[model samples]
Target chain A: MISFDLRIDRRGFSFDVSGQFDEGVTAVFGPSGAGKTTLLNCLAGSMRPDSGSIEIDGENVYSSADGIWVRPEKRRIGTVYQDGALFPHLSVRRNIDFGWKLVPAEQRRLDPLEIVELLGLSDLLERMPSELSGGERQRVAIARALAISPRLFLLDEPLASLDVARKGSILNYLKRVHDEFKIPMVYVSHSVTEVVSIASHAMLIRDGSVLGFDRPSALLLTAALDGSSVERFENILHGVVGESTDQLTTIEIDRISISTRHQNKNPGEKVVVSLGANQIILAPSEPNQLSARNVLKGRVKEIWSSNGKVFAEVDVGPEIIVELTESALNELGISVRSDVFLIFKSSSVDVFDA
Target chain B: MSSDASIIVLSFQIALVATGVTLPVGMLIAWLLARKQFHGKFALDVFVSLPLALPPVVVGYALLWLVGTHSWFGSLGESVFGSTLAFTWIAAALAAAVVSLPLVVRSFTAALAGVDPRLEVAARGLGSGSFRTFFTITLPLAYRGVIAGALLGFVRALSEFGATIVVAGNIPGRTQTIPAAIFTRISAGDSDAAWRLTIVSILLGVMALATHNWLLKLSSTVSRDSSEVG
Candidate 1:
């Protein structure tokens, strides 16, 4: 776990950060120049914050109130710089050993042979830094950092300097590292897509401040999806596997029964159901030979009118609202304290983890 | 006249000989000034460049007084080698070294400062300490600057005039260098002979400037290329 209430003054730009990351990859995502690297530096003991506390895995690495600040070397936090900062004169093997030698014999944590093989650096160990490819150099850099057996790994856009193809290859390796080791990592990146798959917890920063903090799955389909519409989608889910006849791949979310729209699903395999007010159909009595697969009976609890249309609140045990056009409202005569039936085709339901 | 060629030839001998002798010590001092910040830096900096600012007559007088026949250093030299530095080209070279100290110190310091502090920090984070990092990363990288300092100090040594004349005493083919030789011919009112030696000194200077520029250009080119390729 890593936690800090770090406040660093950066030439008039102050970075005030206070958060905790227990395990897995906690992403520090924000626009460029949003104090991402500065925060990482503070945690690494490279840049001392003007004031505040920095605790890593329950260890107080830096604390201003008690007048404590650990040196970078003593802190044992490994950093992978944006430029990789590998010693240009040393070959791959020597560069990796650079950190291992710093660790005392008893404290030495990593097996060099495994790291070399894992990073595919065995063949390139003898080659000078100038001879390695960009991807190869980054792998060596990662191995070098890993060799130290750091308490916390701070990666400052480790693959930001690479091209698209190179970045893809490196991201795969990063995912493997994150999953296999379960190492506490503070991943700094600007891309939303990059953090989606791996980042279990996220801190969204903007203008040198964190805007929000939550799990990645919840954070994504939230407020920032559309600026102009501001249409709050209640993480709407409704769908089913319409193709397969062997089983009903439909799910019931409230009054809506939903099946897979395009792809077929197994029987009762947890499908999401999107319950939109507009798709609901109301009938006074049982309707037969109707294309709709669902017929739910309910009493009209209340009638609310808005935006040149009428909305009826129907009590279907869990309860839901259905929207009707003004003309349809006149024909149905739906009003408060009136009995009504809700009929809708299961195909009308749109389901996605969206 | 045979006198003129021999006089011109003596200047080359002095410039080469002095520069070769001072090169190593000059580089070491330059490195010192560049890397280490001591309590008495201003004093040390001033002391190194004092020979440049002070008149050569003062330098010669100081050297003469320090190593004169009355001084223990001179007496020791006489007793040991049966020779004195007071009237030799070696004494002239020492005088030249003092005057040329600033050149080496200035160039080396600039290059050392240009090396990134973060690179050194990275080296330490990688486990190399104060001394090893300096010798391995800082020194090799600052090599181009050291060479520049060396060449500048060499050129400065070549042009030694007043101190060389006063200490080494303008002995032809012995202590007399090109500048001293030119002084000799000029004192004889042989303008053509003086001008011939002057021409050789000018060529040596032009060659130093060309070499310095070429070296500077090449160093910059190599650094730029390496960074880009990396």
Candidate 2:
């Protein structure tokens, strides 16, 4: 495991983050110039932040205050850049086994032959780097880094340069490597697809600060992914697949049961339900159960404002947040501790990024 | 015919000796210029290239003062070899090397600059130090440039006229080179013999260019093949 408090100042931007990179894949996702790659460089000991501490397995690799900055070459952390950075003169075999044979015989963890086979480079071992495809070159780069048997791995947009198909294949390979290695990795990428596929934990960064860090499933339902960025109807909700009924359906988000008129996939398949939070209407005084497909009664737990709009936190057994206009809240006489019916048009929302 | 032919042969021998003597030092200096950045790097670079802009006679005179058995370097040369460098084949070689230093440096510098720094990082992480990476990765990658520079330096030394005449004194068979002998024959009105050596000069120039082009082609072809495989 690796833990670091990042405080990187470059040009006009400054990034500060405090998080734990546990063993497995932890992805840093954000827009461009968000200092994700800069963080990787810090972890690799190549780019020392303005001031912070970096520790791997509780061993401090760098701390500017204590004068404990470790040089990159001495840092025993493997870094794979976007270019792969394979040595051109060395054959694929030599490139992959480059540092493996140099380490004291006892410390070498993975066998060179095994890495070659794992990376599918056995047939191309004798060939030089100039002879490999982009995908093959990246594989060799990964194998070479693994050959060093380092305690930590830093992958900075390893598939960012490849085409879509190649990127997909390489990302899959990367996921497999992260799963098998058990070494802590700080995977830096801006692509949503790449992050969603392999990252168990996500750190949402913007403007050089850690906007949020949480498990992907939890963060998906928050206001961040609530389609605030998208005005259409976007909401991420976590719920389990309940027993199938009829054309009329039953759905459970956390503990509160909601009847969704939309049906996709079979029962027992857990999923993240995404829909327009704006579609939910608040009704406090309804004479009869109207034509609204989803009508769940829950108390208004919290009300928050953003950009002059309102989002009501509803405690439907558990808490579920809904975004709506201030006019609608006032028209329904909605306030904290007020019991209100939640109406949503089912089939307008569907499960995504399961 | 025999005298003219002998002058031509001796002139070529002197050029060959000069090229052979200057090559290794030129290569080392070129690598230093291309790969290192020390204090006064620009000053040192200018110093290495000075022989190119300076008059060939000035370079010859400077060498004469430095190694002509009277000055400090001349005295050191006398102490080391017990023979003065002036009016000697070695002096012509030294003069040609001085003049050709810039070419080798520029060519080799470009070659070294083309090597990707990422490759060096990969090698170092793989546990090889600076020297190993330079030799195994950097040097081989830029070999065409090195070869082209060497050939260019050799050609410059082979065609050296002003410096050779001043330092080596254009003696027949022992210190003479083709260009120096041709100059002497022209001065003495031996037109037919001068023309013959002129043909030899032309041939040498063509061969240097041919070799340079061949090396360039080979470099590109090899690079293409490697990239296709990689």
Best by lDDT: 2
- What tens digits encode model 1's per-residue C-alpha lDDT throughout B20-63? 76666665666677666678877877887788788988988888
User: In candidate 1, residue A213 scores what lDDT?
Assistant: 77
Model 2, B50-139: lDDT tens per residue? 888988888887777788667888888788878887887778777777777777777777767777766776566556667777787788
lDDT by residue (A81-186, candidate 1, tens digit) is 7777777767889888888887888877777787787777899999877777788878888888888877777788887788756765676677766666667888
DockQ of each model against the real complex? 0.24, 0.38
Q: Which segments of model 1 are wrong by more than 4 Å?
A: A53-61, A65-69, A180-182, A219-354, B1-102, B109-118, B162-185, B188-214
* Poorest 10 consecutive residues by lDDT, candidate 2 chain B: B1-10
* Superposed Cα deviation of residue A38, candidate 2 (Å): 3.9
**Predicted complex 1: DockQ:** 0.24
TM-score of chain B of 1: 0.83
Candidate 1 chain A weakest lDDT stretch, 10 residues? A226-235
